[model samples]
Target: MPAVTEPKLIAGNANLSLAKAIARRMSMHRGMSVSLVEARVERFNDQEIFVEVFENVRGEDMYIIQSTSNPANDNLMELLIMTDALRRSSASRITAVIPYFGYARQDRRAKARTPITAKLVANMIAEAGVDRVLTLDLHAAQIQGFFDIPVDNLYASPVFALDIEHQFRGQMNDLMVVSPDVGGVARARELAKRINAPLAIVDKRREKAGEIAGMTVIGDVRGHKCIIVDDICDTAGTLCKAAETLMEAGATEVHSYITHGVLSGPAVERVQNSVMKSLVITDSIEATEKVKAAGNIRIVPTAPMFAQAILNIWGGMSVSSLFETDTLVPIYEGLYQRS
Candidate 1:
């Protein structure tokens, strides 16, 4: 269709801070005056969601920044309703920039009669009139296939790598990257390779969701400072146990860098009392007061990286190149300075 002047950024109630941060970073690019769309996303007394766009978005490219985090259904509905509003307003294209895609843990059917809710959520978004999707560190990469539209899955590895470099500058040789479970070995390996450190795995048996039966270390962690890498930290049960296991296995220290910090239930208390020295997470999900007050927990902003991704998408450039060594180094440095 028609050429648009600049990207229209929209925000929902899920993560307003992140949306504002993204808007600021986008404004920094090309000296463009970018700001979030003035939309009223409210709820009725009965808890029904309502949306109203105050400004004209007709023939404009729209990006809605919302993370389906806590109260996943509510935030998800906000995104879908916003998408429908943009479509009806005749917006050229609508992209849902979901920093954290909740209900992603139910991506597959692990047992009989279980629903694959991830696919259902994907279908809902596609049907709601979103032209594309942009999310970070999906629980399962294959969830991209569930969406018929273009999907951009960005990683927090580059951000974590930079922080790791800065935090463990001279102790690189004694550093070890760890996967808390077998499934996350690949994720942990990537970070290990980035920092030129060794990789380790905590082999654990799960009796049920959120419960670990037994755990054992697969690689030698003796005399090394361990860094556990994973996609999501929901309850912090497995994560805390893994840290304890690593410490008992002769590891000098244990630290973790997880992308999405769902931190449900007793996660904060567990982390505060755990053996891990620190826990670094991205601002994919808005931090709760408990999480913010936790001494060991630190958040790195994903705004600059996401802004670059949006800029590239609007410019029709390659999104995958954002993770390149040369490209990410600057991103990491910027994140370092911001933190």
Candidate 2:
């Protein structure tokens, strides 16, 4: 095989806007002029995904930017088929850059006769001929083990921390990070430590997924500006309820910083009517019009960080350095200041 020179970005329909943003950000980095590969990812009359690479990809480093988000099955299939196409085209390396990896919440079998869909998705991606995987804020960190290829699981905490600082700059003294459930204590605690704030947990009894039976605050949130941290926000039922519970526990104001805004059924409506002051999410999953229209929802762009990660991977640099708070704070601060 010949030496791979530059990274070629290929995007599926899952999140085209984010892909473009990543390309644009990459171009801005130290005169590295990167652009998306000329490819067609369309569908046939039977809804079968068809992918064609217009440019020569032989021996090139290819990064497929596709999130397995809404219409999960279709987007996932597009990724698989695109990987197969690239492998057949003799690409030297193929990396799947999935910003919002769907089926991540199903990492384990919670009940008998159920399958671990997360592992299944990982297996499918590997079998499709991807040499590496880059994804953000997986629902369960252990999902990395499911992949045979090298996996880089990036966190949104550094990005979220900077936004929280900018938004609650003056009120940091009275800020508290709240985990919506017991399972998310580590995530919330990390953010709390980043901002030098206290941490709290919302102990909830989930009778089933998306349904909260009851919830109680594990720590005192009295007069504090509470921020809930979680990975995915699907229906927003639990998020809204957690905000209300925090208020009842004497919280002055409530906000949320979730990684993936998988705002499915009634999520926007619920957020609009909830007691939360704001719900900040990343551009991992493309925002819907309803989400864009929501008064309390804000989206922090993750493009610069991802673009840097791609560059580091291509240059054989340290990707873990991007995870440090000091490293990303300036990048995010500059991004927010520009906008």
Candidate 3:
């Protein structure tokens, strides 16, 4: 009998390193097992991002990995156009794997005259003919319900937890996972549970976008190593302020773990000289040269988890097991072999 059709992995003009890493994790031959067309994205005279698919994807299961990070609107538009092209080419299925979903913070209308840009982005993606969405660390979990298609929200906490365990094998007891704000308590709690450490929350008020004011330490941090957990660190104002607060509260040391590192404006300099001992971020959004060069910054990989999710979804297996780590021995073995 003839074999069944194989799943195809496609890449857009975003974070090539992350895409390549994800492809490697799947144990698939690069650009051989799939029709990953090179998207020649360019800017127009009007400063609009232009994109063109270089190869055919007709009747193929196309999975495009593009993060709407830097150049948020341009990258987002590129993804939409790529999906439209795949749809026009009659691709069997198209899954948008966006690691860092930009504009997600605008999920709700915070002010009377503001727009819900996140919802608008979600609607645009769905209208662009995306069959499903595969993203990580959304700015707000509630944004998932905004999409009609199935959205697999992956967690970088699992990967971060593993790294923490590997790095601080014996000093786990000294750790105190801290949330930089009330909204991040859930994220910090999960990581704290994984590491078996106490959790703390930072109470803060934001005066304006990219500016945080009046940070207060909610829980005791005296002589305890603090690890601030947040979803995105854009200008580093909140993180820097929280780190400063933690230090003043007699924290033995202050470290921060965030999934998306937007690092806009003068963030690199701020983080470099902050009271933060270390600032770990996932490679969801591609880091700039300046951001990467900062001595206090560290990058963690989420490629393996996404790759496994892709494998499970392709193989018609249960990806739900991804949420349960106590029984993750087999998957780790599988990862070891694949890696």
Candidate 4:
């Protein structure tokens, strides 16, 4: 009889570095040396996806990590194919670990006759035989309802809160969290609550896709260093424009902590030229060379968070408690410059 093993970690080509990071974190937990499962994912001459799992996953749980990022279609197809392969291999369960879920921005239809692509993707994953999903900071929370399988949606707030504590330790109260637009006010408000900072909103209009018409600062940002919080920063147009508007409205400086940095098209250039003091993003999506070249950008690792969630799920524990620290102290404990 073959010896039993814990869950196996597999990686698709989308974000191999993140997968390795997650494996390393898990190894620390297991107190032993372990690595990704032997799997081959490649394409044929016609660009057709091919997947073959070398290790015996029979009766073993599987977590396949793949971010549907740039070249989104190809990456997404790889994930679906891997899921199918694992299922057929007699794996007890297959979890799709999608750090950056693509088509998530199209969760709903803004115009008539447009498809709800997010829901469609969810259906595809479910149909592909995935038992569950593990992802971070989905563009819209409602997208979770699109799937019938168990979906674990993790937040990058804990990671951001820790950084916020370290970066603005002495000036917590004077730091304000601003939403780049009205739609993200709730996200900004939550971050503000976490750090005990004030909340502000940028009243902006979206005249067309990927464009912001104008914005007005709804709250006082004067003399305060502001941090804008949002779920995604694709083109950086909204964030750059918001930073300029905040500075014009008397903000001392402007920064941003966005969960997913799609950073497509002219995003890197815009952020480099923008007045924003810094732009912090999670490594949910692989950062491009241009994003790395941008001087003001910082990346926070999410692998540990994902690794912990995976452990909790495999152990049948609640994943929500990971956000809370051991001291039972409020996440906002810090000296206040305002006081």
Estimate the Cα RMSD of every predicted model relative to the unseen true structure.
Answer: 1.9, 2.0, 3.2, 3.8
Q: Which one wins by TM-score: 2 or 3?
A: 2
TM-score of each: 0.97, 0.96, 0.91, 0.94
Residue-wise C-alpha lDDT for candidate 3, range 1-339, written one tens digit per residue? 221456666676678789888877666522344334565767799987666777676777678899998888778988998888789888878899999998898999877999999989999999999989989988889999989998988887877777677666677889899998888888999999988999888898779775676888888889898988889998898789889999999999998889999999988999999999899999898878997888989997777677877767666676667766543434455432211
lDDT of 1 by residue, 119-143 (tens): 9999999999999999999998999
Q: Could you tell me which 10 consecutive residues in candidate 3 have the lowest summed lDDT? A: 330-339
List runs of model 3 lying over 4 Å from the truth: 1-3, 28-35, 44-50, 206-211, 326-339
Tell me the TM-score of model 4: 0.94
Clashing pairs in 2: none
Q: Top model by lDDT, which number?
A: 1
Cα misplacement distance, residue 135 of candidate 4 (Å): 0.7
- Kindly indicate the candidate among 1 and 3 with the higher TM-score: 1
Query: What lDDT, from 0 to 1, does candidate 1 have?
Result: 0.92
lDDT score for residue 145 of model 2: 97
Return the clash pairs for model 1, or none.
none
lDDT of each: 0.92, 0.91, 0.82, 0.87
Stretches of candidate 1 exceeding 4 Å from the true structure:
1-3, 332-339
Better of 1 and 4 by lDDT: 1
Sequence-dependent TM-score of model 3: 0.91
